[model samples]
Each structure stands twice: as C-alpha cells, then as structure tokens.
Target: MNEQALSVREAIIGRRSVKNFNGQPVDLENINSILEDARWAPTHGLRNPWRFIVAANKEYIKFQDVLKEYGVPKWKELSEEELEKQMKKFRTPGAVVFVVVQEDARQKERLEDYAAASALIQNAMLLAWDQGIGTCWKTPPFIDNPKFREELGVKPGERIMSMLQFGYYDDIPKGRVRTPLEDVVTYYGIEENGEEK
Candidate 1:
C-alpha cells in the first residue's frame, strides 16, 4: 500500500513490533522514503539531530558479525549453539537502522534532541508500516558498550537511541491492550485546591 493511503490513526494504532519477517529484501527506495518521512519530524531549534546507519543485503552479514562479537560479553554464559541461535535472529530482518542523536552540552538541549530523535523514529516506523512493512525498535545494552559503539561507527558526541529492524512479514500481530484514557488522564482548571469544577 502507498504511504498516503494510511491514515495517521491507522498507522498509530495498527502498527506492532513484528518479530517474524518473511525474509524478503525490501527495496532501497522504500527505505529511503521512510527515512525521508523521519527527516520531517519536528525538532526544537531545527537541530535535525537524528542520524541513521542502515544495514541491508550483504551489509547484514557484517552487522550480524558485529552483533556476535559485541554480544559476547553479555552472553558469555551461553553455549556456542545458543549464541549462534541468537545471532541468527538478526538475519531475519530485511534491514536494520541504527538511530543516533547528536548530544548538546546543555541538559535541556540534549533532552530535546533525544525527544526529537524519538519522534523521528516513530515517524519512520509509521511510514514503513503504511507501506506494508514492519519494524521493531530495540535498545540492547551491547549497542551502547564503548567497543561496540566504536565498531558500529558511532561518533563520540552521538548517542544510540534505537536499533530499528525493518522487514516484510507474513503475519499481522493482534493489537495489544493499552491503558484506558480515563485511568491515565486528569483534567484540572476548576476550583481552588485543584478540585474539578
């Protein structure tokens, strides 16, 4: 389906974290379109701090190798077969995007940058979903490790926010339950003492 055919509400409410991919290659053009949509996400002061490192096709092999090497410290206790099984999971996605954000020295600016990058990720995910693609955004501890970050080409001033796995999937996951709006929202502006009018 074309991205324009999907409404914002459908994209927001229907998208799910897809774990199983059909193992088909997604076109580079579609991937670029998703990133372009992400580029339009709002940012404070127009910092446009988001950066992406995409791994696809033959690059996925190198990505899997890096995952295996970096994951060693965290998975030291696992058997070799177990480690291989885990690493194999990385191969299922058609592509993986490492989302990075440039950090600012000022705390508020840094926070805003992070928030903007998060919005960018959401935009990309929804855009992909609109095009009949699936995505999973993850923040594995190993990706933040110094050595791993260096291997992944993450610069000194940039922070990895998410590893977005994109692919085509045969399954459409059922919607998960969300907290009710009444339980999470509160309306004020009534009387003194913060009581509703």
Candidate 2:
C-alpha cells in the first residue's frame, strides 16, 4: 500500500479514467501489489477466469515495436512526425496490462466469466488509484486482430478484455456528474406514479 489506504467510498468516488499520462516509468512491483488485491473480485463458481499480460519498465520499450506493427495502421506511409504523434497515446503510458479472459462455450458461464473479469478490472483500477497511479481501461480494435492476438500469445478460447494503461499524470481530469439517483432508481412494489402494488 502506498501512503495510507483511502476509505472505500473515497476511492470509488475519487477515481477517474486518466487518458493523459506523464512518461515516468511505473514500477512492476507496485502493479503486482495492486493486482494481488484485485484478484479478490467475485468470481462465479470460483472460476478465476482472468489473466494478465503486463508490459512495464524496460519491457515497455520493446512492446512499443509490437504495438507499432499491429496497433498503428499504415505506419509505413506516415512521416516521422506524423507517426510520433499517432504513437503518443501508446508511448506515454508507463505500463500496460492486457487483460485476458477465458471464453467458455456455455453462454451462462461465459457471461459469468466476463462479468467477473469486469469486476476484477474495476478492482485493479481502484486499487491503482489508491496508490496515486492513474489508469485507463482501453479496448482498442487491435486487441481482436488475429495477428495481434498471436503476438500476445492469446490462445484459442481466450479473449482480451482490456488494455489497461497505468502511469503518473500531471493533471487529474475532472469527474463528470452522474445521472441523478432519483432518475435512475426505482422502488419495488411502487408504481411510476407512486401507487403501491
């Protein structure tokens, strides 16, 4: 844990999706600690259907070449400056974790696995936030690319759910106001007009 751990309410409310990141390297040890706690997320039938492929520190440099080949389209045509600008999104993040989940044949089990993995991702984000690390959950189209999947060694019946980027940031993005609770919530046994069932 970095510094003092925040309360659950504080963590949930304060966390934001950070898209802009400073190029400072994030320690792999810190990420490991965060995921250690995140693995506690609910898994239906104890099916811990999630796994991660992490690229951090020096490894991130080599990973960039892979991203350039697969993630950037028509890189062969772009000027050096144009390519640099386009690659900034991938270059800035200090580390990235490709979150992969098992694709069960059964619809119910598959859905359950995805749901559990979603929770695990959220857990990781919140845990990262508590450590003063900024993170973004990205689902870029390249994740599903057959060549890209092969590069990451995603086997048959496994799917990448997120490209979770983590790093330090210069500014905290402002949080958006959520839909009003009154508008989103409904009371059971009460009609829309306030009549009891």
lDDT of the candidates, in the order given: 0.85, 0.93
Q: Write the per-residue lDDT of candidate 2 for residues 1-197, one digit (tens) a residue.
A: 56658898999999999999988888999889989899999999999999999999999989999999888899999999999998999899999999999999999999999999999999999999998999999999999999999999999999999999999999999998999999999999999999999
Best by TM-score: 2
Lowest lDDT sum, 10 consecutive residues, model 2, at: 1-10
Candidate 1 structure quality by residue, lDDT tens digits, 5-48: 67899989989999888878777778888997679888999999
Residue 69 error for model 2, in Å?
1.4
Candidate achieving the largest lDDT: 2
- Model 2 C-alpha RMSD vs. true structure (Å) is 1.3
